[model samples]
Target chain A: MASNEEILAGLAEIVNEETGLATDAVELDKSFTEDLDIDSISMMTIVVNAEEKFGVRIPDEEVKNLKTVGDAVNFISNAQA
Target chain B: MARKVVITGLGATTPIGGDVPTMWKNALKGVSGAHTLEDEWVAKYDLPVHFAARCSTPALEVLSRVEAKRMDPSTQFGVIAAREAWADSGITEIDHDRLAVAFATGIGGVWTLLDAWDTLREKGPRRVLPMTVPMLMPNGVAAAVSLDLGARAGAHTPVSACASGTEAMHLGLELIRSGKADVVVCGGAEAAIHPMPLAAFSSMQALSRRNDDPEHASRPYDRDRDGFVMGEGAGALVLEAEEHAIARGARIYAELAGTSVTADAYHITAPDPEGLGATRALKAAMFDGRIQAEDVVHVNAHATSTPVGDKPEYTALRAALGAHVDNVAVSATKSQMGHLLGASGAVEAVLTVLAVYERQAPLTINLENQDPEIPLDVVTSARKLPAGDIVALSNSFGFGGHNAVIAVRNV
Candidate 1:
């Protein structure tokens, strides 16, 4: 199982890639839409990329709760468990 | 008197180079861009032809990931080239209502359509991406370019096979002459190097099969020539009315004197053996430019290296220029760059404009033993052109009996 730090790094990379944000700017506590200014399409890309990287199937309904980097990391960690 | 149109900016992303200056430099040095394909699909499908002239720099290198993901390869190439041309023109501001786009593609978004079909077959239609329709649309490039530049006058895409690019140029000229727009950004792009097109072209005996020597496969006018090598890229130019360019103090490349588009109405695939439509197009361009054959010094012929296809262009040249065809420095640029399909005309038009502006014509490479039947003065080296006022013509013909020719004069 991947550690919380590892999941955070992966989330950071996808967020930066999909949103075109600075890598250092994407933190665990940052809100995806409010802080990163990511749109729905970008959020979709981020979810897809994270799903691929972490070997997890993120259901569409669960996407609403994963609004921040911390929320995504927690979801993936719990899903792995 | 009619308004004059001049080429103020040029851009290209081709197999020879990523940008206009580099492509032009490689062209002057007689560089060939053909290479064998390394894609696994080649072996998986056992494709007959194993080579292509891909863009020297892939579109992914220049376009942002988000932007690149949304567009098909054809649209990506068009956007890249258009951005370069727009920046090169040095135009800071213009009325959005007076700007327009005229883009072309021989076969649009082949990769996108095929990929979608493959996904549909393997994973069901539910797996297909939502962006497939816009990505695969033939007019996607023109629409994307129009949106990129905020062009409000119009956005047009002409689909005339290989002649599409030149036809776009012809349309741009007409738009300016008709006072529809002050500046028209025009060009063509093609990204059809997928397995299906390769197989189709190979089945039709239209692609070269020199698998052993890919670099020398595209030998236009050579006796040993077999067929054209498929190439992919895009070329763009900013065409502004003479008054507009002069008023802005833009650096003009060459005056787009005249352009003509005609149809053979003879065959769907093969050109008219007598070159009737081609001759008419050439003659009409000269007449439209008010330039006599004697004043024309060079021609960028659309010689695609096929045995039958190469001869008719010569016939058309002789019929159009008479004895002066002997003096015109004919250039078969496909000898080095391969056939760019619809993009060929716009690229060759850029080269012709450069030749006229720089007073140096690029050579026709790989013409080892020139065909005796077609004995026009094909440029064999970077030959110096004559000084004083001169005119040049670039000819592009395509399947479906379409013919397009543009006349460029030194400014």
Candidate 2:
């Protein structure tokens, strides 16, 4: 019912428990450790769940490629396209 | 030889009671800690297993709404347990660097995560709260405990399925022995009693469904055994180096001599049928303690009520300790306390330490029928050890093929 960007923005509500940042925080840029304070473990779960939810076949290594909310939204958009 | 570590404080939030005194009182009196859930899920979804060993009381009864809103149930239980342990330790002022925390959880922040998902689906994107993530992290308890104690040595968390708490205490021993911390707060917490988790576990055939008689529902090692009953709570201990405890005139509980963990890398849901990992973990703990199997007087076994999970632990203990199996009095505590998941092993370890200190071992409830295949000295009611010196071992194995055992001796 929602656009890919909107879906991603919605999913960001899952929140990174460590830093309390919405994965979709507009300020949440590509750099995780620096900008969002999301550690590798939290990032791992977020990516895996996002991949599953969006049907985006994120590869094992490529999951780390996503750095920002925009990047995740792009991946989801491209996959759904 | 390594520096000795001792338990200076203890805390638990369990079905029988919320604090150590109430839990211990009920535990000693052999009161049943199992009960039915009044949750909306019971009538809404018709869950096959409607009963569980909930905390003896609600969390909000002890913690403020501000604190409750900020933390996941697991972290809140952890904070309550840790607060009790810290208060028990008697020392108010501590060097932030010298103090450390190692609290663990098998399933952390599930409530927060699930609630956030529901919010996202129902309320839309912008309406989701900002604090969902921090409230649900597995390390949330350790972080909160660290913040509370101003601990800077490290806030370590080991998510080894159900064995998480035992491993946490084991890590505390290492932290103190490694000279990285003079005093360490350690334990395990689990609050995964939500409808989804319960239904999921039920679907996996891992939960006991005898809802009518909740108290007798969790029957481990019995012929009528179905599966483990889910429980939620936390347990914690304040561990300090002997030198530090002695300097501060703290009452030493017992010496935590050795601890070791190993991975089975075996199965996803089921334990290794042979329990080879558990065997090695026992060996490692004893060898590290420089103690022999003959010295272990009692054990706290990780005996969840699944059909395939109970016996391997006994077989492994037998293989590792050999004929001394007759001497080892085993207490499958989950029979009474319900399975605390991550908190189970740690809470059992606390019970084990209390047994060693007081010379009294708690009873293994609901063990009506001992599996003929399994061979061990399981305490039926309560066993009083003779007034003599003794050593003990507490074993905890997890879902991800993780096995951890810790050895303790009279201080």
Candidate 3:
């Protein structure tokens, strides 16, 4: 299973790449909607890319709960475990 | 009285050029944009036709990766052209409420629609991108441009096949006449060079089948005329009320004196042989401009190089302009640029505005044996117009029997 640190790093990279944001702006505590300006469509893109990267399928119903970067990282780490 | 409208800026990402100046220069030199399509799908699908007029610069070259991925090719072209026009206008401060957009596309986002369907059939619904619906919509370009420019007055899309672009101009003129927007960014874009549309157009016998020589395939008014060559690109113009433009000290290109749109209930795809609807449209455009036919020295004809499509436009011109049609130096720009479908009228309108401003008409290419039936004076070489107040009409007709005409005059 991917560790929390590794999952956070992967999520940061995927969010930055998908939304054209800097890695520093994609902090674990920052909300994707408020801080990163990642809209719903681009969030989906991040999920799709992250799924391919981590080999984990994040279900659609779980998407709304992953509001902050930390939430995304924890969700990915637990899903992998 | 209607408020006077003037074109303040012009932009085009066409087969001949990526910008307006380059397109105008190449058009005068009689350069052909047609070439044998080099896509692998040409061989994969084994399409009957082998040539098309692609944009001189690909959309990917002008747009960022993420931006391009989010938009369909038609919206990409529209945004590219609209941004150029807005920048060219040199208006840094804009009243968001006073701005509007009217963009036209004949077959909007055909590539995206078909590609998504292919994905659904091959990989299931989960594989399809979330942006597919917005990207494939007909009003996508209008919405994209409006959002890009922060236009709040309204965003409109007119889908009248080939006449769509000219119809957009008509809408823009009316919008201003009714005081809905002080400034309007209007034009047309198309990106339908996919294998499906190519095969479908070929099946309808609407596309020219000159596989060996791509350049000469779009020979409008030539006795050996076949059918139109499919081309993809976009053209945009920034239109402002005459007073607003003068107050801003913006450079004026030409006056959009008048515009009209009409429909022919005659047929689904073919034009009326007598050109009654087209003639009425032309006459109404001239009447709207309050200009006599003799004042109209040039015409940018919608001669798409089709066997049946070419002559009706001539008959319409003769009926609308009477003997003045003989003196008019008609230039069929599609002879070089190929038929842009929905974008053709606006592109030709830009050329017509330039012609009226510069007093020079672009040359027509590949008219080796001029069809005698079309008695109008086709400008074989670049010709100079009389240096005075002059008006030029740009004509466009579409598949649903739509006719649109706009008159531009020297300011």
Candidate 4:
């Protein structure tokens, strides 16, 4: 299972690939929509890619709860565990 | 009085060259863009035809990674060409609400659609990208261009197969004449050079099978010609009202005199054998422009190198222009650039505008023996036109019996 730090790094890479945002700027506290400026379409793309990367099932209902990068990274870490 | 429309800027990413200047230069030199296909799918599918005229420069090389990811290849070509056209016009300030786009395509986002289908079959639908719908739509190019230029007046997509591009120009002219928009970015793009289209066109005998001699495969009026070679690219023109262009001190290329569209209503895939629909379109375009046959010094023919297609176009010219057809210098540019499907008309329109502006008709290559039945004054070499005021016609006929013609005049 990926550790919390490793999950954050992997999620950052996927977000960077989809939105062209600098990986360093994708901090755990940054909001995907507000801080990162990722649109809903790109958000879905990132979620799917993140699921594949971490082998986690990120359901549609759970996507809205994971508002910030930290929420996504923790969810992915727990799902992997 | 109707507002006069003029072509203020031109852009193209074609098989022969990536920009208008390079494309025009290569066209003047009669360079053929056709070559054998290099994709692995060719051998894997055991396709009958294995050649196409791909863009000289790949889209990924020009567009940003993020931009290319969201849009389909067809939209990418349109965006590239439209951006060039917008920059070429040198318009730094314009009312966003008064600008418009009339981009067109024959086949839209084929690669994206097929890829999505494959993903659905293998990955059970969850893996399909959310962009598939937007990318696969026929109006995606128009929408993308509209967004790129902040055009709010209107965004239109005319999908008449091969005539789609010319139809877009026709629509652009009307949009300005009707006081709907001050500036309209008009053009067409096509990137259907995929395995399915190749196999489908080959099955219908619409593509040439000159795999060994791909360069000479698209000989428009050659006696031994078989069929057209597929080509992929985009062409764009910035059209503005004459008063608006003059107020901005824009460098006008030529006046977009008139345009007309018609339908064969006879056959779906084949043109009217009697060339009735095409003749009417040609005559109407001239009449709309108030031009006489004698004033028309040149023509950019829609001769796609197909055996049956070349003759009807000649018949239409004869019927429309009467005896004056004998003096008109005709250039079948598909002989050099292959068939760009929907994009053919827009690219040919750009070339026709250049011809009237420079008074030079680009050469039509690979005509060793012209078909005796349809004797035209084909430009076998780079030929000069007469000085003083002159007019040129660019004819584009598409599948589904759609016919479109545009008349351009020296300014």
In model 3, which runs have C-alpha deviations exceeding 4 angstroms? A1-13, A23-25
Clashes in model 2: which pairs? A16-B133, A17-B133, A17-B134, A30-A67
lDDT of each: 0.92, 0.83, 0.91, 0.94
Candidate 4 lDDT over residue span B322-373, tens digit each: 9999999999999888999989999999899999998999889999999999
Off by over 4 Å in 4: none
What DockQ does every candidate get? 0.23, 0.03, 0.58, 0.88
Fnat value of model 4: 0.77
Q: Write the per-residue lDDT of candidate 3 for residues B1-411, one digit (tens) a residue.
A: 789999998889899988899999998999999999999999999999999999999998999877888889989999999998889888788789999999999999898999999998997776687889999999999999999999999999999999999999999998888899989999999999999999999999999999999999999999999999999999998999888899889999999999999998999999999999999999999999998999999999999999999999999999999988999999999988888988888788889989998999998999999899987799989699899899999999999999999999999
Kindly give the stretch of ten consecutive residues in candidate 2 chain B with the minimal lDDT sum: B123-132
Number of the predicted model whose lDDT against the real structure is largest? 4
lDDT at position B120, candidate 4: 94
The C-alpha TM-scores of every prediction are 0.91, 0.83, 0.97, 0.99
Model 2 whole-model lDDT (C-alpha atoms): 0.83
Off by over 4 Å in 2: A1-81
Q: How does model 4 do on interface RMSD, in angstroms?
A: 0.5
Among incorrect, acceptable, medium and high, the docking class of model 2 is incorrect
Tell how far residue B16 is off in model 1, in angstroms: 1.7
Chain B TM-score (each prediction, in order): 0.99, 0.97, 0.99, 0.99
**Model 4 residue B36 distance off true place after TM-score fit, in angstroms:** 1.0
Candidate 3 residue B315 C-alpha distance from true site, Å:
0.7
